[model samples]
Target chain A: MDDLRGGCTLELGSMTSALKAQKILGTAAIPATVVKTSASGGGRGCRYGLRFSCSQMANVRMILANENIRVREAEWKDGS
Target chain B: MEGRELTYLDNAATTFPKPRRVIERMNDLMQNSGGNPGRSSHVLAIKASETVFECREELSDFFGAAGPEQVCFSLNATSSLNFCIKGLLHRGDHVLISDMEHNAVLRPVYRLWRDGVIDYSVFPTFVLEDDGRKTKIIHGILSKLRRNTRMIICSGASNLCSMTMPLAEIGELCRREGILFVVDGAQCAGHIPISLEEMKIDALCIPSHKGLLGPQGCGAAILGKGVMPKTLIEGGNGINSLEADTSGELPERYEAGTLPTPAIAGLCEGVRTVRALGIERIAEHERELFRRALIGLSQIEGVKVYCPHHEGSVLLFNKDGIDSEELCLALSERGICTRGGYHCSALGHKTLGTTNGGALRVSFGVYNSSYDVDKLCEALREI
Candidate 1:
């Protein structure tokens, strides 16, 4: 994971959304993990996303976009 | 009553002897992963959340929902109906319900009407009539469609009798009229086939304990895509913590409190059992039992079976010169389980013209057989 804002992390809306993304990624054989973002780390108080490797960033973005997930490019900021 | 076998014919109330997998899954959840689902990020909490979400996905697939997000768990079918009828209806909106609707549908709609928030019409289900029933029902609904009619609520199958609502036809009518179609699947979820999408239903409310063969205390309101209703109740869904409003997600938006994870886990397994056994097989089994009961009861002197030609899972009748409740008590004394009286649907009683005294109901489950049917008839004859 590289150091950037939402770069390696896919900012899905909720835990359900993140789990859905994980399932989607799983079927494609892409690697992802459900991570809870802290208030200061991601965009809001409590957010969930799929944290993946920096190298898979482009593929993650492209695949999720195809599935209408609408994830943004950001860094995997560790929660406080 | 000691040491005697219980016939257990009141499945319309709640099923007894749930599937083995259902009980095992619930026990497994409580003992192993009894954490708050979607609340914390701990190991047990994550397991609970995953189990709950898996149930959501399983139900969504079973009911033909768009995705797992559409199926929201609740306490039971009554709460789910309240959620849909209350959440979906706006001020001044008109709704139509079938005459055979249970109190689950009638009570909430009555409250909204009493408060002057909305008005409703009761269309005839013709639940007792056999000839041209579907066409008559469709015509009845078309006649009752007001200009502001927003939704049409009907049961996929009646709780009182085996007469089934023509859900596909009613769904098509609602679609053509641009009204939401909601089906109360409390009596038919596992007994008969239902597809939310193919039937054009906006929402389908089902109870886990009844036909689905899950334990009591859980049900769901499965929504179709783009049918988001207003929240009937609001609370933390582990999303949008700081915000005053709840999360704007499919299930979390409606699911306001901590979900009944154990019951949901059980419901998931229950639906799996249904899928493995095949709903078609279950439907015919009940129908065959109903046919035997119909013949057996009809052969008895002074016995009457309502809607005898209309066959599914439930059958309603009463004996001549015998009080309905007294008959039920006598049957109970003989180790037979059955229901009597209005069965909580005044509308249904009026429709069936059973206002003097309500009929006795003997409902069947997949576990029932000709022996059970014969036993019921034999007990009734002795009574």
Candidate 2:
């Protein structure tokens, strides 16, 4: 997921769930590469984006949506 | 402490009117051996180096570290924490931190989290009260750790308000879980008794200028053998300058460049002062001041004190209609040096439900007396 659109980063509870999200999206198992930036431009809330798989994207979006994040296009240099 | 022209109450920030001996020793060092310690082979350099070693020895004994070499000096708590946390943690590692943490811990962790370097989790230690006093327990923090939780960085005492963590319990849990534990003792070093062995702490970061009553710009991290971090700052360690690259070893591994010899010399004196006065005595003295402030704060009609049920100088509150800043200004106008706002502990304030504007924080030190606390009470009453 390159562009998280209106989606925000969810505070997932455990490492297993976070790892599962990565596996589902086929993204890096760690969220370290993702950059967090607030849409407000005032730097308050946070959103994330990176490259991943369909299952991973769906699971991450579902988790984000659960946390009130609205999914958008995965922001990447090349849309695979 | 009473009837003084200026009453200082921001010891949680940085203590003032350092012990006379601390100042005297620093002055003596500056006058006599102004040599670069751990560098030259001259007697003056050796003497200066000896001062560093002796101070480390005293600090090791003070904190119950395994040896003097385990104590590594840094510029301040922030620097020490950077050495302890960032140096040890790698990408994908999971870290658990308490809700009550200063920016020294929060900034580093947040930066890493934002950079996508590690998985971050916060364990709540909040204890809610009817009167707006939020308390937290250490057990709440320990119970939430998962198998992936690799490290735990905690504040020994809340900076926003004085709430001492169940350090022993948390340390034990970390040991049991095989998690690295780092304690930011900025507020507890000289004001409280911290035994590394008794606490089973992996690392203890302390600010020399705060509780230790040393000059500004001096802090240290006491590392246990179990905890070793990759170097954050690497350069000549002064011990092995003949080598092209820096050596990797205790104390030398973390410290780089020229040493803050003067500040450290002052810290040596500060440690001696703490030894002479005894940290237990200091704790007892601060408790008296805290008790007075708590009693007076309780009497105030619209004030709410935020600290643990135990004794300490962390006096946190918000008045009926006054903002934390306004109250702090009001107290300052009365010649009381108290800290307002989040105290660089935004996470702490958030967990305590005072994140909007934070709370007015008044921390005490050994130099503080019952009279200084009384003055704070009087000011709060007027507000």
Candidate 3:
């Protein structure tokens, strides 16, 4: 639901890593929606990423760091 | 599970009577999340990706891989073995394999040698009783080591008989020599306790349908921390779609094309079932069944059981004056499912001196019991 409400998305480079991040976040009671991340030019080649609420960015960062999941990039999208 | 009441003893080829949960999970996956894994961000695709990754995670934990990404899916152990063998070895590299290797390992290495990409040697395995046996095997391998030896590949357990390679010892040797250690875990993954890191195994090739008790058409190459082989077969694995080359990742680099989500789902449940039953308990059960079949067959007149000293999940033997194929056919007529001829193991049959007629292999699984052994013995007596 948080993903539907305007939040931050963290690109994790691959589906395996995105799923891994999702699982780790779930254990921490954070909801995440796995999304296909568009490349820098927004073309066909896509990586996997996680979409979550912007307010949980701090907690997500801390959890991901502790879990050693390096976020390739992060961008915020308005949930309009 | 949905077939006739035949007594299946060819567990070495592929384990039958998969656990109920494995079937259930596979069915559930097909019914619910049937989509290509890692292909899209849609709900079904995401779920499919999750299912595949979950299985990867399960297999990684089961085999003691560095992480889930290290587990790469393939058609079976042969494909994984090919991927590892063809990808890892370079020109002028010398590979050492044991005498009990199945065709999966033997063929690729043979082809590589014939293609002039590498040189290879076959080291013999000797069982000298308890503590001294490992040393003897190691000594045999040490004598065959070449200056360019790049890898040592062996069966975790022989598919022909109960003979098991001293993998930890060989792995230790490879680690010390800075040579890669790879194991064809066709007969040992679920039957034996293996820690890839602990054993310093660079790669372990396994089949989902063998000791794993999952459905066929799926397997994995569980790579160690630093063992990254070149891509044998490549296309797209939902990553780096723009690049002409494959991904520079752990499994995605290897697992090209479509992922077998349902089979992987079955495998996840299968591994869970194995853990539930306890690997030690299951292995002991098979060994006990093996002991029973061994004793029963030995007592029968004109029956010759090979490797009577080795206790394991598989036993090989032949009846006197009977062609192996004929005996196997007779057993089949009696509703006993077993393998005859060379079992696709030219090296193993030669090593065991059964090349002339090969032998009958009766492999035990968790679902099998002493009753099956008794039935096989009684049938042998009748035949």
Which number leads on lDDT?
A: 3
Task: Rank the models by DockQ, top first.
Answer: 3, 1, 2
Candidate closer to the true structure by DockQ (higher is better), 2 or 3: 3
Provide the lowest-lDDT 10-residue window in model 2 chain B. B127-136
lDDT by residue for model 1 (B1-383), tens: 44226888888988877888998999988887799887776778878888988988989888899888788889999899999999899999999999999999999999999999999999998776668988999899889889999999998888898878899999998899899998999998998888899999999999999988888889999998889888988988877677788865778878878888899899999999999999999999988999999889988999988888888889999999998899989988878788999998888889999979899999998877799899999988887
* Candidate 3 Cα deviation (angstroms), residue B265: 0.5
How would you order the candidates by TM-score, starting with the best? 3, 1, 2
- Least accurate 10 contiguous residues by lDDT in model 1 chain B: B1-10
Cα lDDT tens digits, model 3, B75-179, are: 999999999999999999999999889999999999999999999999888632445778889999999999999999999998888888888889999999999
Clashing pairs for model 1 are A4-A75, A5-A74, A5-A75, A6-A73, A6-A74, A6-A75, A7-A73, A7-A74, A7-A75
CA RMSD, predictions in order: 2.6, 20.0, 2.0
Per-prediction DockQ comes to 0.45, 0.01, 0.57
lDDT, residue B329, candidate 1? 90
- For model 1 the local lDDT of residue A22 reads 82
Chain B TM-score, all predictions listed: 0.97, 0.93, 0.97
Any residue pairs clashing in model 3, and if so which? none
Fnat per predicted structure, each in turn: 0.32, 0.00, 0.57
